[model samples]
Target: MRQAMYGLVLYVFLMLPPVANLAESVMTIHMHMQMPLFVIAGMLMTPFLKQQFPRFFAKWNSNGVPGIILFMIVVIYWMIPRTMDEALTIQAIEIFKFISLPFLAGVPLRDSWKKIRLVGKNIIFVTLSVICGFMAWLYIFSPEQLCNNYLIVEQITLGWAFLFLALSIMIYFVQQFFVDRSECE
Candidate 1:
């Protein structure tokens, strides 16, 4: 409950005009910071939601595939450059961004993650890594501006951010490969 309250407070803080403007001012910040924070806030609310809507969640999520699909769809939509631009320019899109990122994407993601098999989890990681790499390549090398609201340099920075994310995921996998579980035991 306390955590949920904190999440709600954080969400409110992010929604403040100055804070929102600052976060949206840079492409990298908007994508990496604001977007993930929204997701985190939603994740924090998951416990309460599960408790309140156990039957509904269980019926809809079932084996978690449906919820995971919904989460992925929302994530993919937000990843598009046009969607980001529209979120900034269009009131409806902005509202949707605020609502969907948390309720639709984050909440479902938290619920699904626990239910998915190990193979399914790995698939998600690989899919995200590929997406990050592809987006990095597109943003870094494209001659044309992908988003009208941001400058070329900002796009390049976002590309680097994506590249860094991809690298981080790779590093995690490598670490997992070499970890000495036997020694720990």
Candidate 2:
């Protein structure tokens, strides 16, 4: 657990400069807020999950559903977008790579539907909280910049974000189903 936390911290610190630059260029407080929030939320959730689902955490397979879905989403977006800006595309690719830790920790720890639902609820709460915080930040810190035209915020597009969330929920359900079948033996 310590190692995992260290790795996550290291990953964030290493990626901070690029992400900060992206936020600066985009002038999107939300992007900056979400980056750290997502990392911290994922990290904090790990121990709670381990405690809640000890059996699942005991045999962690290192294969994660969230990481896979994140990767695929980035790839698909890159392929389909009419004109992908090089910097944003590169940043998304890198961010997707860095998100692997949470996914790896999440997948095999889903030994039951109840636990899966709990995780999903946590994720939703984290995401929504971050969004709200970002909104507040924007209102208080840079109200004028909110309407800037040159600021190209690279947020999770509305459709894509929903899809990603759905995929995660589905993965949890699938994991639960498999675990249930195996336990029957």
lDDT leader: 1
Give candidate 1's total backbone clashes: 0
Model 2: per-residue lDDT, tens digit, 1-185? 67456646755654587754555354233233444344454555566556777666445423344433443344334322221233344666545534542343232233222333456545644554444444444334442433332332333332244345445555664566457655765
**TM-scores for all predictions:** 0.94, 0.30
* Error in Å for residue 12 of model 2: 5.3
**lDDT (0-100) at residue 86 of candidate 2?**
33
| Candidate 1 residue pairs that clash | none
Per-residue lDDT tens digits for candidate 1, residues 5-104, read 8878987888888999999999999999999999999998888889989999999998889989898899889999999999999999998999999999
Candidate 2 to truth, TM: 0.30
**Each candidate: what lDDT?**
0.90, 0.44
lDDT of 1 at 11: 79
